[model samples]
Target: MDLLTLLDPLMTSPLLYPLLAGLGSLDGVLPMIPSEAAILTAGVFAHTGAPSLLLVVVATALGVFIGDHLAYGLSRSVLGPRLINRSKYARRAVAVAGRQLDRRAGLLIVTSRFLPGGRVTMNAACGTARVPLSRFSPASAIAALAWAAYMAGLGYLGGAAFVENPLLGLAVGLALSFACGGIVELVRRWTARRAPRAAGAADPGRGRSPAAASRGQVGSRRVRRALVSATAAVAVLAAPAAAAATPKEADRVGMRSRLDDVVATGAVGALAEVRDEHGAWRATSGVAELGRTRAVPAGGRFRVGSITKTFVATVVLQLVAEGRLGLDDPVETWLPGVVPNGRRITVRHLLDHTSGLYDVVETLPMPPGPEFLDNRWRTWTATELVARALANPPTFEPPGSAYAYSNTGYLLLGQIIEKVTGRSYGDEIERRIIRPLGLTGTSLPGTWPRISGPHPHGYLPTLRDGETHLIDYTEMNPSMMGAAGEMISTTRDLNRFFAALLGGRLLPGHLLDEMRTPGVRGASYGLGLDWWDTSCGIRVYGNDGDALAYRSWSYSTEDLRRQVTVAVTPDFRGDPDHVVDAFLDQAFCG
Candidate 1:
C-alpha cells in the first residue's frame, strides 16, 4: 500500500490532533519523532474538510511549545551541567551559544526551531546560560505560531494548486519543506568553511609584544591600501586586452570565480555579461530551479523593475527634443488637477525625483509573503494607481526642494508622455527606443503575467519558523507597476540599449548631457540615468532594478567602451550584494 493509504484513517480521525501534539512534543526530546511529517500529512487532509486546519495548527503549536519548555527545564536541571563537565567541545559550543544569546537571544531561539537538531542544541545552551523564563517564553511562543502557520500554509497551498491529486500535493509540500532545510544546512556549512580562511587572514603576531604587533598591523594595512589604489587605477584605465593586446584569460577566470561566489552566497541563479572595445563575455552560475539541474538561460529575459524608469525618461527626453514637451512646463498643463501641486511640479522635477511625490508601491500588497501570492495576478489601471498616490499629501512642499525616489513621479511622467504623443506609455517606448535600437529581447509586458520567453524563475524567500521558503514568483501582473517599472528585458538587450544611449545613437549630445546631469546636489541620480562611483574612483552610469524576487543592474563607462549588465534571483538569506560588488570591482577595476 502507498504511504497515504496507510495513514488515511489516522489523518481523518479525532485522535489526529492529540497524535500531532504528542509527536511534536516528543520530537523536542528525541529529535527523530517525525513531528513535521505528521503535521504536514494532517494539513493535507485538513484541506479536504476532515480534521480542521485551525485545530491542526493549534495542536501542533501547543505540542511544540510544551516540548521546548520541557527540554529547557531538563537541560537546566540535569543534562546541561553533565555535558559541559564531560566534554571540552560541548563546553566550547555552549560558550559560543552563550555569546550569541547575550547579543540576540530571542532571534537565536526562534531561528533554531527551524534547523535540524538546532532546537535541542539551543535549548541546552539556553538552559546552561541561565536564560530567564520571561524572555524565553515570548520568543518561544512566537516561534511555535510561526512554525505551525508556515507548515500548514505550505500544505494548503499545494493542496489548493493541485486539487485533482491530493497525494501529489502532499508530496510536493514535503519536498519543498526538505528543500528549505537543505538550503539552510548548505548555507551554514558554507559559512563554517569561510570562517577558517577569515581567521587565517588575521594577524599572525599573537605571540609578539603588543607594540610590535600594532606596528606590524599598521604596516600591513598601509601596504594593502597602496596595492588597492594602484590596482584600481590599472583596472579603470586599461582597455580590454582583445582591443589593445593579447586576450586577458586571467580576467575572464576572475569574473567566473566571482560569479560562483555569488551563488555560494544563496542566490539561486545569476547571469552577467560584460562588453568592451575587444568583445563581449558572459557568465552564469547555479541552477535555474531549486531541484533541477537546468542551467540559467544564456539569453534569459527578466523583469527590469525600476530600470524601466530610464527608458520612460528617455522617451520623455525624445519628446522634449521634438518640441512636443518642455522640461520646465507645469504638470498641471498636461494632467490638470490630477496632482495636488500640479502647477508647482515640473517635468524636470519628475525626472530628477525632486517632485516630493509619495511612492505608491509602498501602499500596495507587494510584500514577499503569502499576501503576494493572493494578489499576484490582480491587474491595476494607471488611473487607479495614481489615484492611490494622490490620496496622500505630497512628501514635501514646493517641488525640487529635495530628492525622494517616487514611482508615483514616473507614473505621472508616463501620463505626460501619453498626453503629448496621444499614445500609451509602452507604445511610446516601443516606437522611440525598442524598435530604433533593435532590442528584440525587451518589451513592456503590460498586464501579461508570463515572461513569454526563456527566463530563470525568480523566488521570494520567506522565512518561516526560521527556514527559508522560496516561493516561485516568476509570473505576476505588471500593470500595478505601470510605467514606473513594468518593462522586461535580457542582460544582452540591456547592454545594447545602454551602449546606444550613452554612445549618442539615440539622443542628441546636448539632451543626453541633460539626462546625465544630477538635479539635486550630492544625489547619485540624474534625469533618468544614475551614476555609480566605484571604489577604484571611476564613474559608471546605469540604473539598478528590483521587483519582488528579481534584481538587475546595468552599467557602462562614459565612452561606452566598457559595460556590464547583471541579473540575479536572490535567495535573500545571504548578502548577494557583497559578492556582486566584488564582481563589479573585478570587471571595472580589474
Candidate 2:
C-alpha cells in the first residue's frame, strides 16, 4: 500500500490513530515525521474515529514515557559505561566522588543523578550505590510518572489546541517535548533536597561499615571517571553540530529559511546556489528529490532535457566553422530527401529552432502511453525514436517560418554530430567539450548509468486505482529524448558548462556570436538557450526542462558572473516554474 494511503487513516481515525501516532513518535529513524500532527489529526477525526479522549492521553502518556526512559536507559548502559573507561575528567570526577562518598557517603552517586548523564544513569547509579532495588524502584517510578504526566498533558493540550493547523501543531509538539524533557530534570533536583537527612547515608552513627565507606571511595573514583567520561561523551555527541557549522558543511545549516520556503511550496525538491563573483560563499537547499535522503551532488550528472539542443547548436556551429557545412546548407545535403522541405531549410534555421519541425510530444502521446516499463530498459539507438517521430511529419509551418521548440530538430542534430565526428555522441561531448573544460561532474550518459555518486533516488508520481505514489525513477531510456533532451548533468557541471559556453570557450568567436544570436518573434532564443528577462532584475539565459517526474532548469547572468542555478528532481511535481522563481527571488546576493 502507498504511504499516504496507509498513513491517512491513522491520521484521520481517532480511536486507533493516537495509539499508532504515539508509537510512531518512538521511532528515531526519521524523527521529523509529524507525530503530534498525526495525533492532532486523530483529534480532528474524533467525530468519526471515537477514540476516548482519556484513551489518547493514556496511550500517548505511556508511549512517550516508556520510550524516553528506554532511550535514557540505553544511553546509560551503552554511552555512560563507554565514557568512564576513556575520559580523564570522568576519571577525576569518579575519584573526587569516591573520596567524598567515603567520608560523607552516598552523596556522589545520588547527586550524579542530577546531571544529564546522572539522570540517564540513575538506575545504574542506585545499584552501584548499593541502594536496594526496592527503594530505587519506588523512587524512580514516582519520578517517571511525574515525567509522563507532564509530557502527556502537554501533548494532549497541544493536539487539542492546534487540531486545525499543522504548523502550529509542530510548534506545540516541540515545545511539549522540550517541556517534558526539562521537567524531568527539574523534579530530580527537588527530590534531592531531603536526601542526606532522610537517610543516614553519610552518618558515622549509622550502621555504615568501614568497608562500606571504602566501597563509596571506590565508586566515587568511578564517578569522577564517569564525569570526565560524560563530558567527553557530550563533546563527541556534538561533533555533528561542529561539522554542520563549517562553511563547506551542508547548505541547509546556513540557509534553512530559504530552503524551507521551497519545500513548503511543494516542489519535489530544490537546490539553490548563492555566490559572490570573487569566490566568497554559496548555499544550497531542499535537496535533490522527494522520498530520498541524498542531497543534489554539487558536481553530478542529470538529464538537462531540451538543454542539450544548445550543445548540439554549439557542435553544429563548430562544423559550420570548418567550412564543411554552411548555415544555409540544406538538410538534404547531409541526409538526402528525408525532410519534405529539406532543400529550403538551413542548418542555422535548425540551430535557431526555426526549422518548423513537428513536436514529437504532440505527435507521439507522452509518458508514451505505457506503464513505463517496470524494469529499467537499456540501449535504445537514437534513430529508433527519430524514425517513430519522422513516421509522423513536420509542423504545418513552412521551413524557416516561426519559432517552435522541436525535439525532432535536435534528434537530427545528434545524428549529424555522430555522422560528422565518427564517434559516439557521448564520446564526442567528452573529447570536445567536458574533458577540455575539466567539467568531470558533467556527462552525456546516453543510456549509461543514470547519474552515479551520492544522489537521492528520483521518483515519478503515479496514481494507480486512485492511490498516489512517488515511484523511484532513477533509470530511463535516453532514446526517448535522444540528443534533444537526454544529457545528464549536475548543478556544478551545468554551471561549469554555462561558464565555458557563455564565456566563449566552447565555440569560436564568430560562431559563438551565432550561438548567442536570438531566434525570431518576441523571443530571441539562441540555439539551446531560453531567454527570459523577468520583472525581477537579472537577465537569465538557460533552459527549462520536464521529463517524467523530473524538472530541471539552469541559468547564468548575461555576463556569466552568476553562472548557473540548476534544480533537478527524481520525482515530478505540479509546479517547476514557481520553484525556480521562488529560489531565484530569495537568492538576493550578499
Candidate 3:
C-alpha cells in the first residue's frame, strides 16, 4: 500500500495530538524517541487537509515544555549533585554548560532544543548550577515553541511543494532538518575551538576573594542581558548580508583555469557547466578531435556510463510510488528462477549494490588494445549477461551483507522493470523522466554504435611495439552495458535532470531521501547516487559515468542551489580525477 493510505487513519484519529505530546515528553529524558520526526510528519499531514497545523504545533510545544521542566526538577532534586561529584566527565560537561549559561542562557537553551542530546545536558547542568527558576522557565517556553514552529514550518514547505504526497513532504522535511542540524553542530564546534580566553574568568568559587566574588556576580547578570540583545540584533542584520553574497567574476576565471587543468592531464577534450543563483557558467578546453584546432563544443553529448543507474533507480522508485512493486520484494517474486539466489535478494539490494551478485562486466573482454576493436560491435542479450554472472559464486553468502558493485544487478533490475510494467525500462525512462523534463539530448541507445550529435571524438591510448597509439574509440555498441551504462546525454541535460530530481520535481520526496540513504557498511553509495564530502566540508550528490574512452562527473548541493557537470574524452594515460576534484572545489567552494 502507498504511504498516504497507511497514514490516513493516523491523520484522522483524535489521539495523534496526545501521542505527539507523550513522545515529546519522553524525548526530553531519553533523547532517542524521535519526537522531531513525529512532529514533522504531523505538520506535513496537516497540510493535506487533516488536523489543524496550529493545534499540532501547540501540542508539540506544550509537551516539550513539560518535559524540559520534568528533567530540570529531577536533576535538581536527585541526580545532578551525585553525578557531578562521582564522574569527571559529568563535572567537566556541567562546568562548561554553566559558563555558557552564565553568558547567554537564553540563546543556549533555545538552540539546544533543536540539537540531539543537547536539551538534556543543558537542563541538567542548569539544575546543578542552581539557576533561578524564573530565568529558566521563560527560556524553556520560548525554546519549546520556537523549535516546534521551525520543525513544522520545514514540513509545511515540503507539503506546499508536493501537496499530492504528504509522506514525501515528511521525508523532505526530515532531510532538511538533518542538514540544518549538521550545519549548527559544525558552527558550534568551530566557535568552541576559536573562542577567546578571558583573563580572570575562572569560577568565582574557585580562585576569587569574597569581595571579587560579589562583584563578579553583579557583572555576570549585566553581561548576560547585553549579550541576549546583541544576539538578536546580529541575527537580524546578518540575514540580508548573507543573501546579498554571490559568485564573483574572479570565481569564473578560476573555474576556467581548473577546466584547462583537466585538459592538461591528457584529455583531448573537456567541458563543464556550473549553475547557481547568479546563473549558469560554461567552460571548455582542448580540441574537438585529434589534430584539430577547434575547441570542444560548449554543448556536446557523451556516453554517460553508470550514471544511467540513477535514471534506472529513479524509474524504479516512481513505479514503487505508483504501488506497482515493493522495494523489499524478492527478485524471484517477479522473475522466477532467473537468479540462483533470487529469492534471498531484494529489489533494494539490487538498487544499492548489496545483492552479492557477481559483476558480469568483469568477465567481459575489455582490453585497451587492438582486441577490443573486434568485440566493439558485439551485442549480448540480457539473459546472456545474467547467465555469465551466475556462472561465478556469490561475492558473499547472504544478500545485503556487503556492497559489491554489480552491473549485472542493474541488468536484472531492467528485466524486473520490464516484467512489472510490461514495457522496456528505456521507454519508462523516456515517458516518466526524459519527456517530462524535456531532456532533448539524452537517449538510451540499444545497439547503436555512434554518438549522434555535436560531440568530441574519444580516444584510448595503447602500447604496441614500445610506442603509444591513440585509438579512436568513440563509436562502439553500448548494448554490452545495457540498463547500466548505455545512455547518452549532454552536460546541460544532465544538470537539468539532476536539478529536477533533487528539487523534488520527479519522485516523491521520501523516495529521493531513500535514494540518498547509504545502504551498506562503510560505503558512500546510496541506492544509485554517490555523495562526496568536499575539501570545504560541503556535501554534494551525483554519479560518475565511464565508458571505453568517455568519462563524466555530475554533482549538486542538497538545496539544488549549486550544481556542476563535467565530461572529458581521453587521449593519453593521466589522472583525470585530479581535474574533476579540482574543478568541483573551484566551482562550489571558490
Candidate 4:
C-alpha cells in the first residue's frame, strides 16, 4: 500500500465503521465532542445500507459507555487524589461524598448517564466511592443505551430529512445544541441551589451521611445519588467585616490607592470593586492565582471559590417560590440517604450551617508531598475527598445544634436539589439562574479549561516543609471540586448576578426572605449570603471565595441598589486580610 494510495478516501472505504465508533467514544471523554456529527456523517454513508441503524446505534452506545467509564476510572486514580490537596474546602467536600455514595449507590450511576458535565468523569465518582464495578457497569450500559438510541434516532431522522431538505437537518442540529446547553444550564442552577446545603446539615435529625444513606436505594436513589454526587465541601465567613475588621471612616482612599498600585504593578494582578453606601467605586488589588496571565483586567476572571454558595442558595430559594422544595421540609424527605439525624435539621439548618457534620478536612491524611504546595498540578475525586473527611469521627454534637462551617453541609444540599427537581445541579442552574439572570460568563468548569476572556495572573506560593519552593500555579485543571468551588467567572458577571439575586429578581419575596434567614448564632450566614454591615451603614450580603491560588468575590446590598465583585491572585505571602476592603472614599466631588 503506497502512502498516497492509503490516503485516498476511496481506498479507505471500509474504515468508516470503526472511525464512527471512535467519535462516540471521544464524546464520552470530552463532553464537547460531536458524537452527533459523526453519527450523522455515518448515516450519510449508510446510503448503501451496509451498516444498519441498529448496529450503528449499538456501536455508538458501547463506545460512549466504555469511554465514559475509562475516563471516570482515570479520574478516580489520577485526578481525585491530587484534587484532595488543592483546597481545604475541596477536602471537606469529599467527606460528604463518601456518605452519599454509601446510600445512593444505584442512583448515582444512573444520573451520570443523563447529566451533562457530569458524565464526563462520573466513573471517578463511582470508583472513588469504592462502588463495585458490577453495579456501575450495568447501569451505565442501560443508561448509555437510552442516550445512544435517542441521539442515533435523531441522526436517522435528520438523515432522512436532509435527503428531502438540508435546512431541516441544520435546524435539527441547532435544536440539539440548544437542548444540550439548556440542560447544562439547568444542572448548574440546581447544583448551585443545593451547594450551601451539601453536607445534609440542613436536616439535623438525620445522623447518617448521604453517602451512607444512598448505598442501597433507585427513584429516590436517583434523587439521593444525584444530589450527593454533585455537592462539594465547606466553611465560610459570615461577613466581609467582622469584629476583626478595623472600623474606619469611609474615607480610605489611601488604602485604596495602595491596593490599586499593587494591582497595576501586577504585584497583585486583580482588584475588588467595592462601593461605599454613598456609591463610590473603590479598588482592592491582587493577582488571580492558577495560570498567571498578566493581561487580566482590574475586574478579572477567577475560580470564584466558595462564593458560589451564595449563588446556589439564591437559586434554591427561587425554587422554593415555585414550591419545588420547601424550606422547612426535612432534607430526608427529599433525599433518602442523608445522615441518620438529618430529619432533625431542616433545609434551613443546612443553609445556615447549623448542621454538625464532622470536619473531614482536619481528619484526613494529608498526602506528604510537594503537590500540596504546587498550585497547578493537582487532581481529586469527590469520593476520595469525602472519605478523607470521614476518616475521623463527625462533630460530637447533634444536627442544627450548633454552627459549624463543615463542607459536608453544602454537599447535602447538592443532593437535595436533584432529588426534588429530577434534574442535575448544573442543568438547574443554567435554566433557572444563569439564563434568567444573564450571568453569561459563569460556569461549573467541571474539567474544561475554557476561561476565554481576559483574566489576571493568580499566584500560588509553593511551600516545601514550611518554606517557599517553586510555585507551579499555572493552568491547573479544576474538575474534582465538583459544585463546591469549581465555578469560573468574572467580576462583571458576579456583580450582575448578585444584583439580580439581592434585588428580588431571582426569587419570590417570601422565598427570598427565607433565603436570607440566618441561624446558628448568626456567626456569618444568611441562607447562602455571607453578610456584614459596613461602618457606613451599608448592609452587604456576599461570600468570600478561596480556591487554590484564586480568591474571588461578589457582593451587594440587600436592596441590590449597590454591588461589587473582586478577583485576586494570592501571592501565598503576607496577610490575605481584607481582600474586600478598600471601600472607596465618599468622593462625590462637589
Q: Give the alpha-carbon lDDT of every model.
A: 0.68, 0.49, 0.70, 0.53
Better of 2 and 4 by TM-score: 4
The candidates, ranked best first by TM-score, are: 1, 3, 4, 2
Report RMSD for candidate 2. 28.5
Question: Which of candidates 2 and 4 is the stronger one according to lDDT?
Answer: 4
lDDT of 4 by residue, 1-590 (tens): 64223434622466665776677777766767777666665554454354677777788788878776776565444454455446565444443333333232334444544555445545544444323344557777886787677666667666665555556765775477457657754664565456432211121111100000101000122232322222211111111111111124345545555455434322345555545465535343432333332233443455776776676676677678777778788866876554666577688877777766664334322212345433233444444555565555657566666776666556566667777787646556767776676555565544433232344444444335554432434344454344455666666668777777777777777766766667766576768777776767766777767554566556677766667666655443333334235432121111
Candidate 2 local lDDT, 413-469, one digit each (tens)? 777776777764555665677667765445454432233333334454444555444
Most accurate candidate by lDDT:
3
**1-590 per-residue lDDT for model 1 (tens digits):** 76556767987677888888887777766667766566667766777677788887898888888887887666554344554446666545544544444332225676666676666666655554334455467767887887778767776777554455656766777677777777765665565455432100221111000000000011122332332232231211111111111155566887887887777764778888888755887767776666676677667667777788899999998989999899999999999989887898999999998998877765654333345455565556668778987888888877998887788888889889989988877778877787777676676755435454456787764435544456677766566777788777888889999998998888899999998888888898899888988888889998877764677889998977789988877665554667887888778877
Q: How many clashes does each candidate structure show, in the order listed?
A: 0, 28, 0, 104
Q: Can you give the TM-score per candidate against the true fold?
A: 0.58, 0.54, 0.58, 0.56
lDDT winner, 2 or 3 = 3
